[model samples]
Target: MPVGSITRGTTNTNRLRRVDRWIAEQPALRHAADPFVVDLGFGASAVTTFELAARLIRSRPDVEVLGLEIDPARVRTAREQLDRTRAGDGHFPAGLPVTFGLGGFEVPTPDARRPAVIRAFNVLRQYDEAQVDEAWRRMSARLAPGGLVVEGTCDELGRVSSWVGVTAEGPRTFTISLRRSGLERPSIVAERLPKALIHRNVPGERIHELLATLDRAWRVHAPMSVYGGSQRWIAAVATLRHEGWPVIGGPRRSRLGELTLPWDAVAPV
Candidate 1:
């Protein structure tokens, strides 16, 4: 457990805003009486955890959030952040619910209370690819029924990202979100894929094949370049659906440089 010294303990103000927004829109946590979310490996600061609570409370007012960190020092740092942000009314935009605790993948709580969402971004990136599946299983096993585990990576600036939406049942979907400008290729996000699929971005891998398909579609849709990158991405996604990629959602999400697909389409084969 203490094999690694500790993570770099890095975090930003709104590093995870997009994932928070997406989670807030989901039906699972919308009606939860005391829907609890956990920010696993919250690094040295729990700002994003607080931000997640602030945003999600708009939809599920009864929700509470807890930031979990493995490093004792990082936990102390998060406690300090809590002290600074001290939530009451204006702590959040409109009085959101939030809190934090110290725990690991085991969640180490006597109450045995599993959370509704466990967000672990940029956490597993430090581990080898082989370690990903076991880590995911260990964490997801601690989720409440219908709970989700969002595991992924993002660029330093949070512009381009990809994550896996895993439920207690197993992994369900994969979503890639990006900013539209200066984006060379949709596969550029391959670099941001979760640990499970990052190294799998090679020939003979499901994700590799999928990204290659998207790249080819992007090239084929190059004629639509004048319409804007978003439009070109939309066309490329359409080509994926036509080729049986099991793509989900419509132009609404695609317009925002997002592409969602069923898990098996890109699941490790």
Candidate 2:
């Protein structure tokens, strides 16, 4: 039996593209001996899982994706969708390397194979914050050596998103990715942060401070907007680095409305 409860199963096509792009750049996926990735709790559709596999296959042609859901019914629905995909009746290519399964944070894999990457987006939002650590431990434990667990949340439209990169050693990085066009503030991501940091975005919390600083930096760089949101975001991230925020990446990543910091920088206080 799966080790978790069923979630709302809300899903939309192309709603995970931001994270999928980030996942594709992960060393774990790029360098894995077996490029097996798991899409844990892929909600009401297998479209995102298929999208993940499609995007990744461009880089790692041998990449295989497994979509997992705790709800047996969702699993059946995804499998049914897979059938159409395999038959060349779906939008995805018939040969897309993807499958559907029943699983949870335990991340059950076939033949005792450990996945190189486990993407558990929006799954833990239903779990209590107190349960986050154990869930992380469970998911990370099922990773192959040098494996990664990309767990986070995104809005229904995938415009605002944030997630944590967890490994066997624990959470390593905190990242927020936003669609720059028409984005109001970097802090808009507060509502979509992963369960581990969502509740912590209150006064006096490190996550709160991070968002506040990001918003302020964004405003301070408002003049750069004439150059485009991408330039404005790049300036804001540079401000963060100048202020000693331990920011990662450079103009290339910031232009995409992304900011990554060491997990400790925004870890719960």
Best by lDDT: 2
Task: Tell me, by TM-score, which candidate is best.
Answer: 2
Alpha carbon lDDT of residue 225, candidate 2? 85
lDDT of 1 by residue, 95-206 (tens): 3455566677766543777788888888888888877777788888988887888888888778878899988778899999887777778888887888888878889998
Clashes of 2: 0
Q: By TM-score, how accurate is candidate 1?
A: 0.90
Error of 2 at 115 (Å): 0.5
* TM-scores of the models, in the order given: 0.90, 0.98
Where does candidate 2 stray beyond 4 Å?
Answer: none
